[model samples]
Target: MGLFPTSPPRIIAQHLQLDLSIRNYRTPAALSTQKYADLRNEHTFPPFAALPEELDPDLSYYEMSGFREFKHSRHWCFLAEISKVEWLARLRLVVRDKQGALVPVAFYTDDKGEEFKYRARKGSTVMILYPDQHFFLGGTTGIRLEKESFCKIVTAPLNELMALSDRVGRYSTWQAGGRTCHGCDEKKVVDLQKCAGCGMFWYCDKTCQTTGWQSKGHKRDCKLIRENGLRAMFLTDRDRFEHFIDFLLPEPVTASESTAAAVEKLSALSIGTESGGSRAAEQTAVIVKTPYKIQPIASKGKGMVASTWIPRGTRILSEPPLFRVPRDNPDISAVDDIVVSKVSQLSAEQQRVFFDLTNIHGTEHSTAMGIARTNVLPLGSDSRSGGLFPIASRINHSCRHNAQNTWNDNIGRLTIHALRDIKWGEEITICYLPTVGSYRERQNRLRATFKFTCTCELCSLPCVYSRWESDMRLRKLQKLDAQIPGLLWGDRVEEKTALGLVRSMLDLFREEGIQDASIARAYNDAYQLALTCEDECRAKVFAQRAWEARCVAEGADSPTAVKMKKAVDQREHVKVPELDEDAFEKWLWMEGES
Candidate 1:
């Protein structure tokens, strides 16, 4: 008992007709007959019987066990439930027949499985027409689906559909004289009310409708019938194969105007302003003048270049992420699945923009995953997530960068500011490395991670002497970064000695021409050391310098810059002798006090 009964009425038989002149067909019970003995011996036997004559006049319903022979130019159909789905090199489905025999179904359409991904879920019934037995490598046999229009998926289990078919055959038949009421079993010529859910089973009044609904098991059957529109699957002439059929077969009625109103109400309630805005809302309200444009470079690919003479501390750009990836998940397959799902939600133009970016990983990863790994930036210094920005991703890497990119929590966007004055036509760049290292070290990391050799200003020093000096300064900065934290809280070191070490770090930063956020961080460290020694005069100067540097690297509205501004304003005014630029530096370092 599948989707059709053993004996269908004449009305259904007239609609479902198949060509019967090709070959003689035998039912499962007639397999041992003398006429088909050789046919059974040559091919594997089918587990299930042939479909009823009213459903398919000449064809037989084959299961997985009977697909042992590969026939050329043969047409067939099978009913199975999807048990598993794989999205690797291709879209492969593991399906189980009624007898619990499992087999793989692979798709080879132009879009692979993308067009059918939404319908390939576990436990859904699939009706594949004209599929062929495919022999895979390593001696495994499976089924292959080549055409997209030849398959259909129903959003229900196989057993439920079979049971619904039996119910439809018994109650939905026309009588010669009149219609019979299902509740009271009386024939009537007068008009009767039909079940709105399934449009079957006439009732005389409300009492009889309720009686049929509750007492006759129509409640469960009506829901399945209405959800899947099961009557069309039984009566339609599918053997003709005029066109493709998708889910919600026979096509649900178009929604009314009231449906659109209800959807608008739900959208307002879920994403309303009273619920506190999201990053998407913040990004919509942001309006900043962009001073850079993306264009092709000589040796490198597309990159951002300054369109105007941007001064230091100018906000170049602010943008939200096109999409984000969670930082905690390590499973590559699961991450790839998530990336595919996120990319599918974008508009057609946005999807084009996302895929147009670079993919250094080549064919090792899927297209979406490869693009994400190449361009995703960390949301914050310590954030557990990363995001891909359409504008920011175009800014290429340089060892000695002219601009700095920072994630601003207050605005919920990534901001780019000029670390130094960027002249017109100058390419805007940012450091991709977590820390500055020697020339050789930076080149090795950039080549291994980004698949490009570095030719930045610092890496191309024009001579061995200049390169050696740059590496020496970077080596000393690394050692001081490691030693400063211990000395700040050490028991044996004096406060003045710690202050001198912080001063030495600043001198190195100036010598290396590092005007990025590292300078702001070093100034803040000096401020902390002076405050610990209770020197209010030096602390105020250090805090003011830190605020200026932070404003230059990150915009004035950045979190660190705001905090430093408050620290400078809250300190008490201290009177001192007037000094020139040369003497102010010595006074700020407490040169005469010790």
Candidate 2:
């Protein structure tokens, strides 16, 4: 609860400046002479060892147990040879430092922090900056590394950097640096070294650089590059996983141009700016014309409103994740910190969107991490990992939602589509609880976890006596979801019975007001059952339903959507001429009864 500064100590930042400059990455000049020099005043982190041990009451018990807390954590840099490092549960790690020191760097998820897998080794020369001291009760004590913290693992001597030219040369941005002329994107420029003032961009000559300063957009970009520590983003190869080795580390990738391009893309994404490639707003605008507008939701701070009536099967929004962390939960604390770092990278408007999100964990945890927990929607099927989409986040929680949210991996964006026709002026919503249950169960889960009592239609029912049908439908839905796997997996199953159960499940979903990704999956199960039984007519119907369900859940462009489309297409010509549509419907469900 007490404040610990996030900024690195002067000594640590200075050390980083030296390492980066010597390695020919983010040079010293670039670090010291930031365009916005006032940014330096933002660091109020005290010198190493400033915070006294007396204030933290539980300090002695932890230190006595060899899990000493580093109260003065900022800029406490150490050139340590790792004697031992263990990957503990929840991503907390314990490492023995060279100076007979043992510290715990607790909590790192597989996002930007995943880089540690390559760095933390038995005998690697690792330099960690701004890690708070931490001591556990059972002799496992070390520094706690936050998401903003970084470590530079010296795989090769600074003198030998030139030897890695072949590998580094592949990164086009590295070769150009600030030397690339902003006016023409040319590296052949003469005297196009660092910009004399900000040290962020380069130009061919005084005239070209001036044109860049005035017209080519470098004038605006130079300020952002200085503030965002974009040089750090530029120097690190996000994909190059070179493990730290004394003998033969993998190819030394000096930098990644892809990361630089991403940073540039973000920098260009100013409010009211023209829409361009891969920008989140532009891509979403393509599908839903003037899709939605953010407005105040009285009790809930803000919510997404249906600007116009959005029809079922419409892909309302498709956008890249504001930030994505690995779906793993080695430690909740470590993952949360990494999420904070990613949020820090968003543009002004993007940050505004993120900060404006509702956090149910108010006053309990870090602001950014809390909002992430409250707003993050699952990105993958297993729901192991997730992402934050501001537009989707605005659609508040309800037990019976008006809209369905899905993560479309093909497009790499979370898509929110109207499950039914969402009328204008209506507040769009998404169900937060995993699966709908009895009224009491839904209420307890939402209240305990999200810290709010849900008053959606299902929860708003007068009493158990009056809402018998709703409760019965919810109970049946829960039971069906549980029994589905066993029903599908059985060797000697009754195909007709399984089909009937699937049909009942769909009916229950409708009765319970459930419009979810699971609906598409349920239809898929029905499609499989009909196909295995050689009921082509029924299979085609189920497949078409699955296709439409997914079109409203996943995007129309997704592979599953395309496959379902084909299933319906393949059956267009294969019709039994003897039976009409109603007769065929009776035939599919009545095979066992007959």
Candidate 3:
């Protein structure tokens, strides 16, 4: 099909001609004849003269008709002006159609109407494509906009858009035989210079162009046409719809390039980095083969399972957030708006993956917001913001997780490392809790915060005695953890006592089978305590252990791991008598002294 219906040009021109004739015939008898004459003289060319004689043949076109002519079965495309905006439980726009009828336009997108909140203002012209009448539950019929790609908001009013369209049709189309000068109304056989601003209107000379700009409202029209890219949209074919398109739509991606692009964009933010230039670029350069695959677990909806044997200390995955949300925002509506805006910025494929993520919040929040709230991982332990990672989000939670996730600020990505050897087909899991706790405490927190019951291997220990012993060890570890912090920079506790508390926490970690970053953190705490006591030999051993543990949990590239490595390397070497493992442990902890 050609751009717009073949008959629209003739039909619109006839309608304009008839309207002008009627106005002219009634002008002499009216008391406002002189006012009308003055208004007519203000413009050099009549409005109808702006209308083109022909439409482009490359694009498909729909009839330029009123909403009243629309049928429920057929898809319709048209332009309307927003008369009123309703921000209630749902966003609704009351628009004035070409027939002057008020029609409701309701948004049913993933973010509801929040995606269009910026542009859904009174008098803004909305260009809608393939819209169908929606029968509301309240017995009202209105247009439903389900996909963001199917609509665009031109910041100008509807009447102004009509005028712009007319101008674009008249001047933008190329004619081999001759072109009409917009200012002089003279046909030129030779090529005419086009207006530099809009590049739509042609002029025979500089003087004529100036006349067109000042006398024919070309100045305002030129600005609107150039700013909005109105002429390109008119020339481009938009008959086919595929995925959701947004304002200032990016260049189309081929099917072959889309998968890689989506993975790169969704997995990494590529923003400011400490060491690497862009996290996305660094990851792209070193293509780490995925060791896990997303599949359904028995109780969990979807989880990442090992596709191959993943050894301990191996980096499973490193990913950046698809989008980030502020963690401290108390206003639910404001948060929803933020999520909607971020989601709208993603590519169509990335958006689909984002929406497919788990939404534990359910009906309480919008779909986009719910997915964000359910899957967001903190940028760091004490971060003010959290991000949603597409692949990392699919890893299910386990009390006894075989892998650990740490936010590495140096690379600006979340790195996942295997804490234990994961057999082929085994599920790769991560602990979601901030700290290890007793069975009851862990269950309560998981159930309340994540809306799920813990049934991981640790939580499902068959023997009651085993469970009890595990809880006791965890309680002792928590108590030791609390006491170690106070002794860090204070004279409240003796130096030996502070080192002993951290050593006890490490012992409990072994007894409790905690192989995550907590073990590394405990060793670091012990290293700090030894340094405070000016024990270089003991501090070297503690720092080495901290470095090793951190490397296994957060990878060697982690900032904390690098710092621990530096601490271990920078200290002076101390000569001591060669001893066995048991004797070395006693000496490192200074057990024989006191």
TM of each candidate vs. truth = 0.51, 0.49, 0.51
Give one digit per residue, the lDDT tens place, for model 2 in 103-127: 5554432242455654555654444
lDDT of 3 by residue, 1-594 (tens): 001111111111100001111111121122211110111110211121221222221112223233312111222255678999865324679888666767788775546677787778898988664443444423466676655655777788988877766665555544555666888877776668878776567899998898889998899988886666454344322333332223333222234556657435422422212233222221211112356779999979999986554556677888888888999989989999999999999999999999989999879998999999889999998999998999999999999999998898998888888897565667999999998799999999999999999999989999999999999999998888887888997875476778778878878888778899898888888888878888777777778778878877987778888888889778746544445445666777768677
lDDT of each: 0.65, 0.56, 0.67
Each prediction's number of clashing residue pairs: 0, 13, 2
Off by over 4 Å in 2: 1-289, 570-573, 576-578
Tens digit of per-residue lDDT, candidate 1, span 535-587: 78777877877887887687667889889988987874754444544466677
| Superposed Cα deviation of residue 592, candidate 2 (Å) | 6.8
Instruction: Give the clashing pairs for model 3.
Output: 4-61, 149-245
Ranking 2 against 3 by lDDT, winner: 3
**79 in model 1: Cα distance from truth in Å?**
90
Could you give me the TM-score of model 1 versus the true structure? 0.51
Task: State which candidate has the highest lDDT.
Answer: 3
TM-score, cand. 3 vs. native: 0.51
